[model samples]
Target: MIRGIRGATTVTNNDAAEIVNATEELLWEMIRANDVKASDVVSVLISVTDDLTAAFPAQALRRIEGWTYVPVMCMREIPVPGSLPRCIRVMMTAETPKAQEEVVHIYLRNAVQLRPDLSLTRKSEL
Candidate 1:
């Protein structure tokens, strides 16, 4: 079986270090929540808001131990008026035994507002 795990997070600014740090954090959380192993991952597609240009979020995935062979790609999210800014979104497809409903989607930081229903944290807490 195969499933897709969605995750998104935001960085406070456009700093390269901040983007890398935030992306890595989000990836780790998603992995932990779903118990996903790098070996099982098929590919990861990442999109970032136009506002974030300091770095490629894929850098974080490349840094993960044992993830060297995983395919990853990054691109800009479609810019819509009043849409969230400085956000990084990821769709990770992997071979897993879990059902679609069993996969946990993660939304963190300011990006939580993008999908309040899937977010574990309340808006007030962000």
Candidate 2:
């Protein structure tokens, strides 16, 4: 089946370093949680909050082992009032045997508030 793993994290600043590091952390946690292999991943879609214009979240994938060939798309999220700032969100589509309910969604930092129900794990608590 084709499954989607979701992850989101808030960067401490607008710097490219912060964005890349936080995104890498988030993706690592998500991959570990889902027991996902790079070969199983079909594509990755990344979205950043309007306030986060320093870097593309997908750029972090370049540093990740075995993910060089995976396709990635990046976009800017809509800025709604009271929305979280410096937030980066990712949706990874992959072929896996796990069911929807068994899939793990990750949320870290201030982005945890964005999906309390869907986010079963937090990096800070790990």
lDDT per prediction? 0.91, 0.90
Off by over 4 Å in 2: 120-126
Q: What lDDT tens digits, residue by residue, belong to model 2 across residues 59-125? A: 9988999999999999998989888888999999999899998888998888889888775444434
Off by over 4 Å in 1: 121-126
Q: Taking the tens digit of each residue's C-alpha lDDT, what string does model 1 give over 1-126? A: 989999999989999999999999999988988889999999999999999999999999988999999999999999999998899999999988898877788898888887888775433333
TM-score of each: 0.93, 0.93
Candidate with best lDDT? 1
C-alpha lDDT (0 to 100) for residue 12 of candidate 1: 90
Clashing pairs in 2: none
